[model samples]
Target chain A: MSDLSRLSLNQATIKYAGMEQAVSACLRAEIPGIGLWREPVAEYGLRKTGALLRQAGLTPTSMCRGGFFTSPDSDQRIKDLADNRAAVDECAELGVPELVLVSGGLPDGSRDVDGARSMVLDSLAELAPYAGERGVRLAIEPLHPMFCSDRCVVATLGQALDLASRFPAEQVGVVVDTYHIWWDPTVYQAIERAEGRISAFQVCDWITPLPAGVLLGRGMMGDGCIELRRMREAVDKAGYTGPIEVEIFNQEIWDADAMEIAELTAARYVEHVL
Target chain B: MSDLSRLSLNQATIKYAGMEQAVSACLRAEIPGIGLWREPVAEYGLRKTGALLRQAGLTPTSMCRGGFFTSPDSDQRIKDLADNRAAVDECAELGVPELVLVSGGLPDGSRDVDGARSMVLDSLAELAPYAGERGVRLAIEPLHPMFCSDRCVVATLGQALDLASRFPAEQVGVVVDTYHIWWDPTVYQAIERAEGRISAFQVCDWITPLPAGVLLGRGMMGDGCIELRRMREAVDKAGYTGPIEVEIFNQEIWDADAMEIAELTAARYVEHVL
Candidate 1:
């Protein structure tokens, strides 16, 4: 069995729950770590939520997101950078070490994925130092390639590492989400390559018959084909001793009671991801 | 602009059409080639279909498809291999040089993606010589990573090439479908690496909000975001001057009039994919 101390409940897994409920769910499940989303933190007042988590003895594992820098418009690019900077500030305030980023997709009517990827590098270059100075790592998360067109241009851990290679390990890192990277053939090698630069080790399952939009199709642990334990071991072997955040986004998962889902996630994590 | 002489209508784009309708639509659109599917060819008698294509002066660009070699059961693997051999024979009989192979996904209840991938190599080792002797190249088509679980495990041009590298070039090669590979960060490098071993160059567009059961979610050319022209040029530069087959699988396209889709595909070929 795995240690419950390392499992973090990412708030998006029970997206229906607000700060207090999410905290309660995590507490009930005995999941020692909790990943916060900027929206919930903002809604609950960042300082208040941070205070509550600290009082409850919960480690804020990471922050949900802070990157969508693929817009071609200079104004949009400026705004996106500012938003990332704000996210960095939020992570720092919440005592979250990792600020996970989902790099934005191609510009409207644009087919230049290469160009979009370069924009991510530029975004990273600008944000990494700021994040590092604030004791936060800008964690680039590569979403599944299915989301490459409309969601994230970073489609592989190798690509994420490539982007992070330019920055110090303290400044920039990559999010290793099993749901996204499990399908990659070079995944193990990439995981090994990401040793020092792994910011967040997120867990989720990948199931088929992906729903429309494909964003909320992540399966719960043991509910899909991914060898979750194998991936967990790979990440662990790669020298990441941080929290393993359960970050599922399925509609079915979200529709369930938050406490029930969190407890179930904890149980499944032990069964499938240990 | 691309040469009309090199354009091939892969029948799946207008999947509603039977062999006769596909041929008629190809004729109406002045397309010089057609990619045949095994199901339709079996429905229309192999010899008769081959004779009809020859009479219509249309080249059989490729045959779709032949490879589900990921089954773990020894008996099932044997069955799959026998079926693939039969597919190669069908392709040979139909005068199609490229037998497009979608190496099957993880076996039911199997999470061994690495083991499943090795099975592909073993399958290739068994099938390549047989295909080479029969004047057919087993063209491994690495599907988009989205299909990596249940449709095709070979999910990148690089992986396909790795499987093909062991076999003689005359026996094994790969299909470079723009829709499947366009999102890859190393796509251009992989394409260049696949120079002499590129057996098929299929074209299609990729749009967002992927329909449930994404098998039929491919977009019509010029309808979605794919750098079709650039990919085509890359293939040409890589020394592949073979028939550029337009293979789309979309419910919307399937529901459309076959001849209209054919004509539109031709127009889109000129405007978007040339």
Candidate 2:
């Protein structure tokens, strides 16, 4: 069996699981960390969820997300920034150091990607310090280009780092997700460049024949063609000694039994990623 | 009416139409150029297809594709190389100057992307000379990262150029497809770097909620969020004054009447791309 010491469950991997079941599974499997999402945490009551995790001695690795900073509408931008700030507060409350930020896609009906990216930076300017003061690092997650139009405008790890460079390293950093960035030609160098700014190292394999909307296409570690172990080594070499979170968003895996999913993920983490 | 001077109808846009219908639509619209795919041209008799385009006073802009050069099997690699040579011969036969190369995905069940990319360069080294001798430039088309797994491994214009840079510019160049490269953060600079090495400029807008396969997700020019005119200008500024090929691969467009698709593409080309 692989070492589960650094393995963190992103919770999205077994997407339908309740907090109670997720923590129970982690505790049973000796998985030391669990990354929580905002919606489910709110549903379970944040204080109670924190109590359960603290009681179980499970480290809350990172929060789900807190960035949609690309809308053209002024009101929408204000609301998104506020939501991001609230997300940072939540991360601080949970004792999670990193809050994942999915920079939103282009403004509706706008074709200016560069402009949208600029807006991402502008929003970061406003939110980074606030997050830093809360002891929460804003981790910019670069979703694959397939989601560039609908989900995150940050399409490359390099771009994410470029955005993060403007703010303090502790306040702003990049997420090195294998699923989103495995296809990048400059990935190794970008990972090396990430160095101290690497906030969270998320793992998921990229399987082909992406589903409609192309949202839930992530694979279990060994099921796809990603060089998971190689990337893990690279991220580790770049000074990232944090929890390695498995964050597959595939539908079939989500539909499977939660405990089974966690078990298989742990096994695969040992076989393919470790 | 939009200037049909440089507009080229890539036959795949009206995917079901025969050679005669495609040529007729282009002729009727006064579109001066056409891009042909190998399958349909082979079906129609290569010489006869050439004669038909010549008779219709149409220019054959580019040969659809010729690069699946990423198999570990020696026999498969030999067959693929021979096929690429045949594609070059077809391009020369139809008097087309450029043959689009879609550097294939990873070897079956392989996670070595770097190794797959190296294989692409090795194949290009063999094919470029043969293509150049026949007066055809191998146009390295960097397909979108979404296709990096199944369809094409060259996932960025910069990567394509890096591969192309090793060969003589006349023998090896790159294709700038709006649908593929528009999401790239450094795209504009990459276009400028392409300079005289740009062999073809293909236009197709990117739309979201991509279909299951993600292959037919290309949108007609103005129907999506891509800034086509800006890219068109950049390509022109990069010294590419060649045929502007409209190559939409949407199944819905393919199902529509051929003539209507051509007309709408022409209108959109004028409005959004010209």
Candidate 3:
């Protein structure tokens, strides 16, 4: 049986919940770890939030998002780098070892995805060392291909690993989210290949007839067609003993009470994933 | 300049038009060919439709679609095969050499994509010889990965090519549709690898803020962000000299007058695709 002790809640799942409430909910529900978003950390004051989680005996599993180096404008690129550097500092301040990076999409009026990808690699070359110095690994999260043109150029776990492979496994890794990589034919092989560099394993079921904007369609566990158990098994077999973060983005779920949602997520994780 | 002589109007782009009107409109516009859908041809009397198009000197580029064998139920699978066989017969009667196949999604209550994919291959094995004997090639059109669960298990051009490679190039081939494949990072390499096996080249741009159903979100050419010209150039370089069929599925376009839509599609084809 898969381990339930490592279950983590990404703050986005309960979109309306503040960091204090989310961390408290996780602690109350015995969800050992929680993934932090930069906005929430900023809102709560990073140092205070870190102390709150630590005081409550909660682990900060991973940090959400620090990568948007695809801008064609040099000034924008410089600003993005500064923001990313600040994100790295935030990771260190929060005592989280992994910083999740969602590489930005293509530049304005540019259809050059290759150029965007090259910028990601180039930025990583500059930032990985900085992150490594601060003892925080950067985890590249590959968003689904549906978001390729606007949200993320890295649309597959294999592509994430390809980029991550350029840096040391200690400094860079990949995030395997079932919602994003479930449709990939070679995902199992990619998971096996990801072995050591699998920094975070995120779970979110995929339901179709996607709503407008496509961002809020991530269904809760056991709610969609994704093989949650199968994906969990693959990640487990890949030798990843890290926390499995539940990171859903559905609107209706977010409208519910935070504690109720946390309990439901835990039950679903046990039944459908663990 | 790209050859407009090879341009074909996929009937879906002008969904409001009857087969007779579509054929007449193509002829009026000096368009060389048309890709047809089964429902209209069946409604118009297949043989009569074929005769009408032939008399109008319009080539029958391809027939739209015949593959939905992902049902877990044996009876449904049998029915799907029967329907596909009937579609192949219709292809012969319509004088269309290519029959597009959108392999259906996961079976009910099942999340096994691998199992669904195997069913596709098995169904293809049964249908390929039947199609080949009828002088038709089954063109596996991989829908975007977003549709993998509910529409098609064949979700990548590479996966389509892999399946097609198992059969003779004359009997089985791949359809390269820009709307479905524009997000694929390895698409250009897949196009290069699809040399001599590309049965059809379909064009449609992809616009963001996908609609509620995400089905009718295909943009008119040049309105969205796809590198349509690059994809056209890739297909041409890959030795696919077949008709370039415009196949958009936007509801707004469908509500417009058929002749106006056809003219706009042709103009867009010349400006954005060719």
Measured by DockQ, the strongest candidate is 2
* Candidate 2 displacement at residue B194 in angstroms: 0.1
Q: Give model 3's TM-score for chain A to 2 decimal places.
A: 0.98
Q: Write the per-residue lDDT of candidate 2 for residues A1-274, one digit (tens) a residue.
A: 5579999988988779999999987877778899889999999999999999999999999998899899898998899899999999999888999999999998888888989999999999999999999999999999999889888899999999999999889999999999899999999999999999998999989887888988888889999999999999999999999999999888899899999888887888999888
For candidate 2, the lDDT comes to 0.91
lDDT of 1 by residue, B1-274 (tens): 4569889999888788988899999999999999989998899999999889989988999999999999989998899999999999999888799999989999998888889999999999999999999999999999999999998999999999998999899999999999999999999999999989999999999998888888888888887889999999999999998898999888878999999999998998989877
User: Model 2: runs farther than 4 Å from truth?
Assistant: none
Candidate DockQ scores, in order: 0.83, 0.85, 0.73
Error of 2 at A239 (Å): 0.9
Binned by DockQ into CAPRI classes (incorrect, acceptable, medium, high), candidate 1 is high
Question: Any idea what lDDT model 3 has?
Answer: 0.91
* Candidate 1 reference-contact recovery: 0.74
lDDT of each: 0.92, 0.91, 0.91
lDDT of 3 by residue, B1-274 (tens): 4457989999988888988889877876668889999999889998899889878899989999899889888888899999999999999987899999999999776788999999999999999999999999999999999999899999999999999999999899999999999888899999999998999999988788788878888999888888889999999999988899989899999999888887787788888887
